[model samples]
Target: MKIIGNLFSKVLILIIVLFTLMPDASLVMAEETNLALKKEVFVSRETSGKEHQKTTDGLMDIKTSSKSWNAKSSDSITINLGAILDFNQIVVYEYSFQRANGYKLEISNDNISYTAVKEDSGIIASTERNFRTNAPHYVGVINIEKQSAQYIRLTVTEVLENKVSYIEEIEVYNSSDPDKFATEDTSLNASTDLVVDSAFGFKAPKVSKTIEENYAAGKPVFVSRETSGKYHERITDGIKNISTGGHAWNIKAGDYAIIDLGNAKEIDCVIVYEYSHLRAKDYVLELSNDMSSWTTVSRVTDYVSLNGETGEKSNAPHYYGKIEFDKTSARYVKLTINETAENKVAYFEEIEIYNKANKMPEFNAQPKEEEIKLSAPVVSESIPYSKEKFHIYLFIGQSNMNGRDNIPNSERVILKDVFLLNKEGKWEYAQPYPFGTKYSDYQGYNRYSSVDEGTKNGLNSASSFARAVTDNIPDDIGIGIISNARGGTSIEKWQKGSGEGLYEEAVRRTKEAISMGGTLKGILWLQGESCAKKEGYLDKLNQMVTDMRNDIGGIDDVPFIASEIIQSRPEGNVTIRKISEKIKASDYVSSVGTNTIDGLHYDAESQQLIGVRFAEKILNKIYGVTVTSDALLASLYNKEIQTEEIVPDYQFKIKINGKYLITDVEPIMHENRLFVPLRAIFEALNSTVEWEESTKKVTGIKGPKTVVMHIGSQNAYVNGVAVQIDVSPMLVNNRTLVPIRFISESLGAKVEWNQEIKTAYIELN
Candidate 1:
């Protein structure tokens, strides 16, 4: 009995220790439930081949994860956890690298309101990598802190063109568990008929009464020419992520895609997202009912012609094209790739077709070309408004300009005489909504009272900007906010011309707004988040500024405030601010957002602040106002960010054999050669310089020798002898810069460079 008692005592103590360290058995049983297993999941949009399948399979291993779910671009998936639960974390599971570019995880209970939990690129982290069991290596697992929700949503921001965004499985837990997912709630489980895909599976969402449908989604695609790859039908595969097995079809120059809608349907719009970086061809879209005769539906039709003269290198931004016209009936739509760019291919990813009557609720791209034309009448005879005193401000950019942050009723303001351009091409009283749709899409919808607008119906910087502009001025001096911005759109999408693209649309609207007897006070811009990491952003931005100034009158006369973006990515803000320095008439404002809710967008307060800044900057820069109506506003806006004065960036102090020489254009070093203004150094040596614009030749004449160099040529002629220069002569602010050492030495001056103090000494003895 004593021996038995000893063993029992030890076992009982062990049990006590286990119970103390581990969670209470009854508590775990009551709290730990896999809320998503067999629960009803809803997807925003479901295509044919890449459909939403049974993701609640209660498995996270690699093999079973093949039964994945899919969501289209800018589409979302929502899962109902049956009832509200105080869950602390969400553990989403997916395969490796087989995903889109970005996605957002959100938590909500009522289904109408949502809070973005995590909005990161769906890439796995080093700590989350688990090659043995799950894929994603761990992009799907998002943690929610001090939060409770019964419903969760995941939205795919940008997919690989037409590729479907996929995920293996999603599991919600009460704790941040690594592996142990407790048994699901039996009461919430239901018999599902959705088929489990053999490989990354998908089941189409059942047709709903109100779901915005994609007509050409998952339809049969027949290419005019196909390469060796198996992606011949990828156009209709509804796959937006990378097709690693094969690239999208861009094999041959004349390759085209023919999408069969399965039945004759009326369509007006066709949008295509191409994969290749080079595609500067005039694409033709034709529709047919009998496959014999075709009717041309225009747009991006004259690509090369629309964008001035070709030979300028094309890029990926030009490929995301859309064509909209009068509604037409057709069963087959064909897209032909133009064959202009040699060595560069036109790889296509996704194509969507839509009718005017069945336009997606969220599709407020650009109003029809005819609608933009209708603005003339409104400008002529619409309502009672002043043309001279009414100041027109064009607001253009990406979502930040379009408004992504929610605004409370307290923040909502509708000023008298302040107007917003409506879809009807008429100026209407500014609405209380924070977010602005395309000028043509605004139906005066107000969401401030409903409250908790989330990302939808939020306040835009333009509205706040307008209110700020109108507050101090006389009642007669009103402002019009022309909202023309699209979310997730690259700056390339706003390229000049491109056949009724956003750029041309903005130009037309600006002209129309001016026709309303309003002076072009200024243009407010906030973009660059899309291609912040893309190369040649400066060149593209300069081209946009040049093109806009060329198209709009007085655009160069006013302050083109290029605003910075959120702190999440500092590259865009850094790059965009350079425009103010590069362009004389332009200026920049600091980002008007802080404490970002999702690390991507601003909240209501930030948007209001943005408006205040725009008003302050425009008043300070354009109107040359030293004092604002409010003393605080003047102080806030007058805070200088970057000085416009010409300052030495490299801290260079030029010395001609020890005498400091001040230059109008700062001397910069390139290719190990210190470049100085051709006239600055040449004249310092008493040498006269002559420039030939036609030949791009810089000729410097000294007492004994003469040297010649082209604007962008490294090869030069010194005393009639050929010489290879290390750095080419370049033009800056209309002042030509040439290699100082090469030019000074060629002109009989000894040149010495100081590495310590960055002083260049030119000796002329």
Candidate 2:
């Protein structure tokens, strides 16, 4: 008995193991064969009787009933399955009413031989009378005995109405249980369109809205305003509770987003759900096979925004709306919101695209090349340049970096030692407007209108920066600039490998500049305003620097310096501070600026000053050459002010670099010291004067230094450092006056005051 029990337990264990390893029988039986792929078709004569026949006009369109093929009276079409296929069912679709009383199906193993079903056989009769009213189409499913045949013939016969027998499409099924894969009535004109293949004769319904639905479920999206993951974040999070408190993809006019559908699809309509209380007034729908290239499909100058409750709702009415355009096949759909009705932010809660499956073959039509007659070859003279003698720098960023301010007369003259790599990729005498025709490749990334024009007014800091560098460096070493910048661009545009990305173009131009021969010294960047509202700017900029250094070979440790945007509004203070701190703390960046004018861009005077500051940074960091503010002043102005002492009244005469600073106003005694007009000395030192009424502050700038003082204030700041003055700056005759000794000495200039001779001397450098 014990031996028998042990043997029985071993047998049970073996049985359990065998059962665990067995394949699923249900899954194996559920698989069905599809024989309607890669087949050939032949028709006796098409209804149109033309080369362009409607019989083969994408009868497999599957989604919409707008396209159809017609067969009038006794029209027979033959289909070669290429191999023997066992099919149990056949379905035929009609665009209009069913006029054909019967369809006779014949099967043949060889094209020359055929076998037809007898008339008495019940396979050819149908009276279900089911039709898709919204799609306006009729389908007839005919059940047939399972048979294997290589060629099948479908004939429209037994015409009942006026000898007009129209067949929109046809399909065949390989499953023994024909209902297993039948097109359900619920799928017609429903949320999803049923896609059927009529060519191979299979009822395979592909989901037409798959592309858009997949995007909402987590696909990549890019926007002009926000290039980071933020663009797709709000859309794909699946949180459609569009309460005013929740996050949304908010944009202003001229900002747009691109939804990548992953592959090409025949698209016609798009649905957009806007944020509460905000709707885009104008929008453009565009399509593209390649993400880099795009063609506009439709433009909606005025679109209605709606409000709804829950599940894609905003506070406003009709939060969701659909837009239809000319049918087009594209892999990418770009929706650009041009303007908003209330001038409110164009915020979107969700966006979905609807497209049909592309049944046609892909054929990219190329433009024909025009024939050209060759003329005599022209020889060009080569200009010689020493590669090692040139020190190159790249100027990159948005409008402020491209320089919107006018160039001052004192700084307009072209410096012989400085060269500009213009848009044409040739080096010329360095001047303002680094973004010219040569650097116009930046237009590919610029979404703004003013940013693309080559003839637009541009005055950038590159020329001034080059001039300052050349003034400080030795004559043998020439300075060159690769100027590539666009106005109203964000840091996202500067990312690498992005289609129509400025960063990719910048690196390409940088490499091109390097090929022309030169030691790339550094990069000059001055942009931040566009992305100030968002975070992660530091990471994006750092990655850009790394990519540039890696792409532009032989410049691994190139220095990148940026400028702190002038934050004129209180709201921008934190963002500006963060950007400034990041720039100052970065290892790739050597130095950043503290100068700005009007908060949006630097003034003309500050632009030159910033340029001098850039030179100072390069000189000190790269060449180990120390540059003082006084050096910038002396090199920039080259003017002199004379001073004389009057012994009788104990009055002192001051001279500004061997010339008189003021011929109209003499030195006035205040608190036992001679005071001079602030503008007189500052202008003589090549500085600019501007008064801010909002802050009651007087700001003066001269090449790398800035003196900011408030009216009736005893304290003043020089280059953001605080210092006390013996006599506060006073307003006399609507001009600010300051103590000569303190202002001159603080700017690294020599100041001398003689009590007996009443004479004062000031040397700039």
Candidate 3:
């Protein structure tokens, strides 16, 4: 009985030990509930397709026999997870190269019915290449409320530019799983559709929004773009930790993320937490009563290294900074990013405005030296408001001068030495669409504003021209541009002191640009298209130049370079070129052919090239620098044409001022050289043509200049002076054909080509 009792005791102890060592049954079931979104388990199906079908059925392996769900005819795709699982997030991998514009996610326990979870619109395709994915890959994560779903559906509602759409892979994440997809309450201020750059994935800050709110109890502020997520809120939400992501604003220079106080409020101090990884440098803190006008309170230009200043890293990736001011008040605050510290991206974590509704000190009252020292932890010296010794150039003209080309990616970058007197009457990094459209009739002067007050805008050549000039000149020389061109304005409107018109506004802007000791170097004029067919336009142009030179400090002999206007029809081109010839003949006014595509306006590429020509003219005529060979004068705008044997394709479309020519004899391409019937094109251009049979030579006369070209020879004579041509004159189909450039240019006329349309334009001076 004792031995049996001892055995029972041992068994009882063993049972107790087993119970103590066993895992929690509830936890084991929860672990099984938290199963990862397995790719193999996802029985994927897609919208039907004629090609690349069954491709979206499995994993995103491109090497296998893959198929794609095309969005050619249909614009929706539905995926079934095949089993009920608790999930909240769906991740999709785009086709190897194609992308969808907009899509929405829906979930349902029953496949017949689904609930909408998340939707995004205007999502741009990924430009950065990921070799691991074998193409430009972008991942879209759709978040939903925690729920059990047997099926999930993805519907693409919009496509960009009708581009081919497909999905390489899809993933479902359980929202309840903390390790994979934790639900965070964050409200995004910037469009979430534009925020897919986090390929490495993002970890929402572990700290609660309440922590930041407690820190900003009294000072009130609102941001233009806010972070929208469960873990985040608008700028006023008092987000302090880097664990919570920041508010991403527009990345362009001079674009600001504004803070509205609701009304004019006095504020003396502000604390800012820049993005943990990316942040702005050389920014501005400005105050304003009306959003239209702003006063710069501080300019922060201290160079913060890529990871931020050493020892100042409170949040590892985030940099903490403070901006303190002499006590003042206003309703609106603006943080204008002049530049990014490292990347061309901008974002901020939190901002605290202190001394709410503090009354402003008396105006023009100088503070005691001791008062300035105690305002902030880091006191900054005020940046001087003057840009001394900068070289300023005035840009004025009609539509093409105002700009017609859309800004290309290559030209959108910022340059340090090149600056523009922005529409706001402030110097900022030069950019496209620099002209101010709206003029307040409040005063006789141009009190400009950078705000887009319903302005019609496009990219112009002035910025590029300034950039080129900046590239060629000494580094010490700052290049400034005053863009005053108004689209579709006539010469009469550009006359100096034309009483509250574009010209008067232009003069005001020019004076404002040179107010701080910058030298007015020259004027870049591209006009005459509006009055291309008007009589006595040359006289009007000459008078306008004379008036402008006098108004801008009576500087005689300032170089006024003009462009041979482009026109849709040949006759209009002839009429404008005649006037352009007179301007070119003037001592101060020079002319170069403005390259065009549609026969009306200079395309972006041509505008870039023409801007280079403008720079070349500036170098030669003003600075006396040699851009090409010594023989090619800097004043010569066609210096590039003289070097290259064959010009770019866009240089082939020709226009005479306001008209495009249609002739019975088409221009011929021989041995990579362009040849046209000498008589047909010239006669259409209003020039008298004669053929000398004895020498197989043709002589064309327009006004004072005569052009002579002989058959089968590249030698041509302009007013008795011999010049070399690209191609020799030839006879074909009983018509005499000559190298049009040589013949046309020799007669003091301008010739241009439109590469986009494959045509030529000729203008007789």
Q: lDDT for every model?
A: 0.61, 0.58, 0.54
lDDT accuracy of residue 742 in candidate 2: 66
Per-model tally of clashing residue pairs: 16, 22, 43
lDDT of 2: 0.58
Q: What are the per-residue Cα lDDT tens digits for candidate 1 across 541-590?
A: 77887888888866667777877787435555557767766665887777
- Output the better candidate (2/3) by TM-score: 3
The TM-score measured for candidate 3 stands at 0.34
Q: What's the TM-score of every candidate structure?
A: 0.34, 0.32, 0.34
lDDT tens digits, residues 1-765, model 3?
999998888778667655765655554443323222322222233221222323244445452112444553235555555567777666565543346777776777767777887777855333222222222244555656776877666666666445456566565665444334321212211112222224323222232212111123223444443435312223333333333343323244555666667677667776665544345677788888998899988887752222232132222244556577887778777776676533445555555566624321111212212211111111112212245447788877766765544455555555667666654566765543323443111110011222122233455666557766776777777777776665567778766666636766767778876775577788877777657556777788788777777787845766776655653333334554454366533322222334442235576555665566677778777778767422232332333453322122232444565454445566777776567767766776678988889999888888766788888987888777676777888879888877766666555455566543456656553
Regions of model 3 farther than 4 Å from truth: 1-388, 432-454, 497-500, 567-599, 628-765
Rate residue 173 of model 2 by lDDT: 67
628-667 per-residue lDDT for model 2 (tens digits): 5346645776533212222112234666665535445667
Q: Which stretches of candidate 2 lie over 4 Å from their true place?
A: 1-385, 432-451, 569-599, 638-765
Error of 3 at 736 (Å): 8.1
Output the better candidate (1/3) by lDDT: 1
